[model samples]
Target: MRQHLWMICASLALVTASSAMADNFGMAGCGLGSMVLQSNGKEQIFVGTTNGTSASQTFGITSGTSNCKDDAATVAAMYISVNQEALKRDIARGNGESISGLASILNCSDSDALGTSLQRNFGGIFQNTISDSKEVAVQIRQSVYSDTTLASSCKAI
Candidate 1:
């Protein structure tokens, strides 16, 4: 009975080990090192060291390369944060260069439609007197993501 129990424990250990090996990224996460090394085992040390030494992981996360992809909503939020004032005016009026620029950044086909949609939802986005750009950006992202026309037209949504 003891021998049988030991065998069962060993089998479970093997299963756990194999499952861990099946993971896509190693201890370093997705980066140039992980892409080049191609191992989720001891090679992770080298992968992690490479990522730390080169800072490629940050670049990979930002540029959507090396198995790391950037989120569209995050990109939109960043854009909104930078151009908060201009975007607010544009969104309020239902048209402007800032709105068109944001639409282009989000990969939306029709900037006009995006502007109009945001114009109608201005109250929800600004919320009376919210001055924080990041908060406003999040609201803009939510508005875009929830709109059928903007969401469908915007690739990043």
Candidate 2:
């Protein structure tokens, strides 16, 4: 009976250690410049743009889908498409001379401000669609902004 109790204690210790290791690794992997958050209350996952960087952009799901972990990649792809479209629009509208301006526009002064702008912009674009697929698209937009910033930052560094 004592041996069994010892074994159980050992198992619990292993589980605790494993979880700590996972958390540490996850944080380390994200690195210094990146931000990370899991969706908790709502189906929305917001990725806000970074400050003091021309790569500020916000990505989020306003309504429709919930629990976006399974489709992260797909959502990321869609964001790329949306950003491309936004770029084209910006160019046509004479907003800026180059794609870099799009980057600047996305890189608003603050993350929360960027998020508010994105919610307004994307809300209009995705108003008609249903939630599940639309949410994935929203995720894609967020991914585009985040990926673009990361890529640009890497190039700068």
Candidate 3:
């Protein structure tokens, strides 16, 4: 009886481990990171980090509308653009602003802001950092409560 019990526990452990591994593999195939965003009972965003020494960031947002996918794409693009701008400013000023400061300037308050600031101010935000090669990725999982996700990307210059 004890042997049977031990076998069952081991089997359960193996199953759990395999399930977790499968999930990770599935995410990798999608070219996305481990973070997934879901809101309004819908999946809305996915983010992935790139491997490199340069500070990089990427994110996607979906709103369940005709422009949902496009809006998400735009957000990702703007994130990169804003990050580059912030990096230039930090380099010129020689100051390291908190992630919050950078986010405030971008009018964002969340992990997305962190990713945006890192991209905009790579030089200062990730200077001499071992993780510079890894991109801080963000993804919009859902946008039901707020259309700001779409507006932010659309208004980005």
Candidate 4:
């Protein structure tokens, strides 16, 4: 009787684990790190298995939380934080590759328009000591909500 109950419990655990994994494929290092799982929701850290977290850490650029920022949508948030100085320089330079790269990372549609908008709004959007990826992400996501065609073409990250 105990053996049968154990089998049933293991089966349920497998099913629950598989279900949680299905939620985010792109988030799993674009494809490779699927076997490993990460969830702060789980109290035990997947029964002390660090396989998934290690794989995620190995693939730094792919992990959304790679940058170690407080709040980030994905690795892109980390990129934004890391590149703040470069972005500031690019915005100051006016309509160029760095601005375009910034636009691409932020998921904006029009490179020129985003460059122009960031150039125009640099003073307000960026700050001296703040990385501001979360703040900028809020603005971009809000663009999807309130305004979609404001030349910047902000989209949800």
Candidate 5:
């Protein structure tokens, strides 16, 4: 159908744009939805719904495909980069879904503690005009390592 083709083309265009700028994935995480919907903002809700409905996110995570397979650092960085807007809001508040998700990925035992730590060092982790996810990830890791309790608590960071 023409509508389907247009949607696919639009999705690809979004993916290309986001990938070129930040090498970021969709808010749906890793899955078919992520592949088809790479833009941020409200479109993320659609992406998440698609992934959830299709169960591709589970498959991708289990099978290590669709951007699910990567080193801890790389995955963490990609997550941080893709969820910058959420992270920005949550980090300012010192607790939210983004922080919780990051804690899970980084294998931290205490999501609240991690969120607090990130909130405490918000300025440093989110420094001026950081376009690179890897850079932001490194800063986050460094922030975690700087805190003695958090360093010991987060096994993957």
Candidate 6:
């Protein structure tokens, strides 16, 4: 029981620490995050362009050294944010890939027919939007731990 609590806490901590950040809709200031970054194996580069309100104040913010746009960062952000939604859909539909992938991440493997059971009972654990994904994750961990079939679905890590 104590071990189960620890694992749930750890999973929540990890998810909270790694939630995606929303994108900047307007001209954004250049920071080190904007200056040096890369994702999806592509080069990352961005510029602090002159906005209508502050063109004179923002002189030569862009280096213009690289031709690549900042799309790599944008796509990276999108992928992370949208992945949670995709996982929810996949779990509801019992997509094997999504289930197995999530199991691997959470270090829970099926010893018996845990996957089948989870598919049958998915609605019990996932019935609403995950406003706090980390909290939801913790709840899921606790649920999985308490349920015999769900616990069997994962390998003890």
Q: What is the C-alpha lDDT of each candidate?
A: 0.79, 0.37, 0.35, 0.52, 0.82, 0.46
lDDT score of residue 143 within candidate 4: 37
For model 4, give the 10-residue run with minimal summed lDDT. Answer: 25-34
Give the TM-scores of the predictions, in the order they appear: 0.67, 0.27, 0.22, 0.50, 0.56, 0.38
Error of 2 at 20 (Å): 3.9
Candidate 3 residue-wise lDDT, 1-157, digit = tens: 9999998678656644544333232222222222221121222222223201111212222222211233333444455355644544553453445333434443453535344433444444344434221232121212211344433642321
Candidate 6 C-alpha lDDT tens digits along 36-134: 221212222222332323342233235522222344323333332456566566666766565565665445656224355455556655666654455
Backbone-clash count (model 6): 5
Candidate that beats the other on lDDT, 3 or 6, i.e. the better one: 6
**For model 5, how does the per-residue alpha-carbon lDDT over 1-157 read when each residue is reduced to its tens digit?**
9999998888678775555433356556767666666667788887788789989889988997765667778789889989988988898899999999999999999999999999999888778765466777888899999999999999987
In order, what is each prediction's RMSD in angstroms? 8.1, 15.4, 16.1, 6.7, 13.3, 17.9
> Where in model 2 is the C-alpha error above 4 Å?
21-109, 112-124, 129-147, 150-157
Candidate 6 segments exceeding 4 Å error = 1-82, 111-114
Point to the candidate with the largest TM-score: 1
lDDT of 5: 0.82
Among all windows of 10 consecutive residues in model 3, the one with the lowest summed lDDT is 51-60
lDDT of 4 by residue, 1-157 (tens): 9999998678657745664445332232322233333333452344233335466444543454432222225645566666667766776665777667756765677777666656666655554456466775454344333434643354534
- Tens digits of per-residue lDDT for model 1, 1-157: 9999998678656644554333257678877666666667897897798788889889978886666764566667778888998988998899999999889889999999989889988998898665688788877888888888888899876
List runs of model 1 lying over 4 Å from the truth.
1-30, 37-44, 53-69
Clashes of each: 0, 6, 13, 3, 0, 5
Ordered by TM-score, highest first, the candidates read: 1, 5, 4, 6, 2, 3
Best by lDDT: 5
